[model samples]
Target: MLIYLLKRLLMTILVIAVTSVIAFLLVHLSGDPAAAMAGEGASPADIASVRETFGFDRPIVFQYLEWVGRILSGELGRSYYLRMDVSDILADHLPVTATLGVMALSFALLLSIPLGVAAALRPNTVIDRVALWLAVAGQALPSFLFALGLMYLFGVYLRVLPISGGTTWAHFIMPSVALGYYATPAIMRLTRSGMMDVLQSDHVRTARAYGLSSWRVVIRHGLRHAIVPVVSLAAVQLGFMLGGSIIIESIFSLKGIGYLAWESIQRADIEVIQAILLVIATAYAVLTLLADLLNAALDPRIRIS
Candidate 1:
């Protein structure tokens, strides 16, 4: 187990390293950060001064090495547009995005797992069809559109929930639902398929023949085995939610990392954009590693594989 964990950790570190390089290069490739930082009306001298002050005139390799070194030294650089520490900006907004991601993932799992179990248990019945229809609709519907509908129904029409802001739990409900629903169909279908396969196994039949209660057999034995894949899927989905919350955050005025990314892009805040990309990529790699560890723990066979 320790060896497996070490291997996964190494892989994650490599992924983050690669992602950092890509993030840095991509931002640089977009345009001259120094030029962008200088106002359009500024003369060439101003751009050169900005470039020299920021070390942008240095070799790209040296700049990348210095950036990585600073990152290792717990510095994320200063934001060109905001005139604030990049790390401070992220710290202010990361919690909101993390909270939203957790809420969204929890909502997705809570809703999808039950529906998947029900659909699997009663395949081809009305219950199953309804669940399938819901899965389809979830996949087909755009999250922004769903967010709008939710805002109208709950915020505008019913006036029960707040339309925007991350100040309260109530404010996150619509955004969470809308962001999470898109992931529901994939999780639900995986659960349904996994459960169906598990149910058809000889162990399940033996458990049934042993006269165990149906629910107990299903939950204890069936779900325990079937949920291995779902755990992995949930981790990936959570990472995605964290990275992809820009649209939902924009719609609902939630000040999260995603919103910060949007703001940085508009202003060409290269440092912030690069930091955000690296952070998100690191998050994704870490989540995948956690999922692998969890799956290994749940099924020892995973450790061998």
Candidate 2:
């Protein structure tokens, strides 16, 4: 287990390093950062001065190295537009996004699991067909469209929940449901398939033959084993949640990292952009690693494979 963890950790670091390099090159290649910082109507001399001050005057390799050193030293650099430390900006906003992501996933599980289990238990029945149709619709609809529909029904018409804002629990309901519903179809399908497979297994039959109640046999002997894949998918879905937050946050006025990243891009704030890319990529790598570790822990054969 220790060796497996170490290997995963090393792989995570390598992936981050490679991502950093690619992000750095792409940012530089996009256009002149200093020119973007200077804004419209700035003279060429002003842009040159800005470039020199920001070290864009140096070779790209040296600039990347310096940026990496600052990261290692915990200096995330300043946002040219915000006039604030990049770290400070992230500190203020990441929690909102993280909370939204977790809440969204939780809402997704709360929805998909029961529906999935019901579908599996009564395959070819009305409940199963309804669940399948819902899954199909969820996968077919875009998240933004779903969010708009949710806002109209729940917030605009029903007035049961707030459409936007992250101030309270009520504020969270609509956005989480909208953002999470996009991933629900995949989760529901996985759970349904896994449950069906487990239900057909010998242990389940043995439990049934022993006169265990249908619910008990399904929940104890079937769902428990089926839940392992769900756990793994949850980690991957977290990455999806974070990445998808950019659009969702925009719709809901969520002042989170996703919105921050969008703001940084409009301003061509390379410092903030670089920081965001690294942080998000690192997050992806870490989540993937955690999923791998969890799978290995749950079933040791994962490590062997």
The prediction achieving the highest TM-score against the true structure is 1
How accurate locally, in lDDT, is each candidate?
0.93, 0.89
Q: Write the per-residue lDDT of candidate 1 for residues 216-293, one digit (tens) a residue.
A: 899987998999999999999999999999999999999999999999998999989999999999999999998888
Q: Please state the error at residue 134 of candidate 1 in Å.
A: 0.7
TM per prediction: 0.97, 0.92
Q: Of the candidates shown, which would achieve the greatest lDDT relative to the real structure?
A: 1
The superposed Cα distance between candidate 2 and the true structure at residue 41, in angstroms, equals 3.0
Error of 2 at 126 (Å): 1.0
Give, for candidate 2, the lowest lDDT window spanning 10 residues. Answer: 296-305
lDDT of 2 at 230: 90
Q: Model 1 off-target regions past 4 Å? A: none
Would you give me the overall lDDT of model 2? 0.89
Tell me the TM-score of model 1.
0.97
